[model samples]
Target: MNNLLLNKRIVISGAARGLGLSFATACAKQGADVVMLDILADEVHSQANLLKKQGLKATAWQIDLADASNIKSTIDNVIAHSAQIDGLINCGALATGVGGKNMMDYDEDLWDRVMQINVKGTWLLSKALVPYLKASSAGKIVNIASDTALWGAPNLMAYTASKGAIISMTRSMARELGEDNICVNCILPGLTIVEATAYVPQQRHDHYVNGRALNRKQYPEDIDGTAVYLLSNLASFVTGQNIPVNGGFVFN
Candidate 1:
């Protein structure tokens, strides 16, 4: 436990039981107060309880990031309680299960749902939190993206498109927030194993694992350390970059 994030306050979205949870726990271990927000009430609360058991400050906020009004209120509450946030990890996203279909087979409604959460949610949440981040001496924003966004996947047209938007937004956010001392970056994770991936076809998972240079499946832990680095002093000079944590799945 190096207190890389000592006394810092971080906000992690979709942090019930996956990559988001991993980041939240790791940040806690590093001495940062963590606010976990997810749609699942019981699960999020359970996670908060676990963190508390470890003697970490944790709060669970039930939120639907897709709703602008709710996101606004949530941000107000978070800032009110924490005073200021040192970092923000926009890990909330909706993919195939929530409307990621092949381009030709994709319905407009399904596409809208994915875009609303994955792209619009990220944009709005970050926009709302900009003021707090700007006020911090070490402000960082890490947007979770997917490698398919870079290479473009066929069946996951909507997910890929939304992620591409996220990547673009990351660069633009970095440029705009730089003068304010806020670092905006995106992490394009490979096919990492998580609750979300349970819906993915087994063959698809196998394909990703076999194709990766590492020839192994990616776990949530693989990306947790990267998240820590991006939010710490170690990455103070880094911004507007899309760093891949996908084990050479889609080298950029």
Candidate 2:
């Protein structure tokens, strides 16, 4: 929480709540000017105001990741406000209430929705911001994936597939952006306690808690330190890696 991120500006998606909110707070604490983007405009604005009241640097913008035009406009406005975008945290996704069905029971609409938001959203947002990231002296990208994808978690096929794709995309993005000195990486967190995972079955939660080597529940905060590290100069040499931050629930 020192001045590691001082003078750095980071844009976090899905910042209205859940894990994204945790990332926003952590980045602010580390002295980064935080740009919070989410479809929940009111909530993100309120959260940014809260950060401001805490004497932290934060801004809010509404962005629908699934909509390309919205993403382009938001990116332009973000640049207009400040041309330098030092980092990006791709945490936005349609996670809440998108589970509880087996792959066979999953409808085409459900699968497409998950892919459009979770997979395509990550791609589109990163695509829109890479130019700014490339322009930075040191640029970093952290794509939030999931342990479910590593373990092939049942009844969550579509959602898991989307996250799996993110992990792969992280590697490809890193290679493409490396020439610009932009480091792209992925984080695979076990099922953490957040608003997005509130609907998860108790049984699944128990499995995560008991299966982990730590033998404890994971929270959004558990993922923050790793995120802060990846976003800072501390990880300047790191890129295209899939880090599993699930307290040893599953090895990647």
Candidate 3:
């Protein structure tokens, strides 16, 4: 084991699958106890069991980001069970079929749902967990934003706007939590090929692959290293920054 995150207890939202699952697995590999949260209860439990079978400390919780009450209660239960939380990976978000629509053509309901889950949900969960995080000796928050937020991607206004909000929130949160020894940072991932993104049009996928410096497909595993580093001691001084794992799609 690398032991980079040894003895740490980390919470990963959206951990049933996709990038969130990858993060949980990576953290656990490095010796961190992982609390995996997702709306898909069965999937989350199965994933957690798989980790346990690997002799790793892992647990699953079902949570609906769109529900504030659920978020609070779930977090409270997490704290009650885990006793302390060292880090958080905010990967829970809502990006259904809202892409490929013009700003004017965007569905109001879809836009509202995206905002509620992606923007408000991220903030509220972080807000509710801040107290427990502050109590830890090493507190870190890694918010998963999108590269589209950096260079606006056409036809993805709602998702892009929500991620932009995440970046801004990360900056402010870093400042506010600095005194408490909490480090907040944002990771902007490129167009990764995940189960959730299988519905993305082929043309859009090609556009992302062709425009990248790598000129290849990006996967959830491509982001694990950066996420692990940000949550590990290596990033002790890194805060309020936006790091891109987008195959150099947008240069920082």
Candidate 1: residue pairs that collide: none
Tens digit per residue, CA lDDT, model 3, 36-64 = 99999999999999999999999999999
In the range 81-161, model 1's lDDT, one tens digit per residue, is: 877789999999885384335667878887888899999999998888888898899799999999988887768888888
- lDDT values for all models: 0.89, 0.94, 0.94
The residue pairs found clashing in candidate 2 are none
lDDT of 2 by residue, 1-252 (tens): 587889999999999999999999999999999999999999999999999999999999999988889998999999999988999999999888778898778989978988998999899999988988988999999999998999999888888999999999999999999999999999999999998898999999999999999999999999999999999999999999999999999987
After aligning candidate 3 to the native by TM-score, how far in Å is the CA of 108 from where it should be? Answer: 0.9
| Candidate 1, poorest ten consecutive residues by summed lDDT | 95-104
Better of 1 and 3 by TM-score: 3
Ranking the candidates on TM-score from highest down gives 2, 3, 1
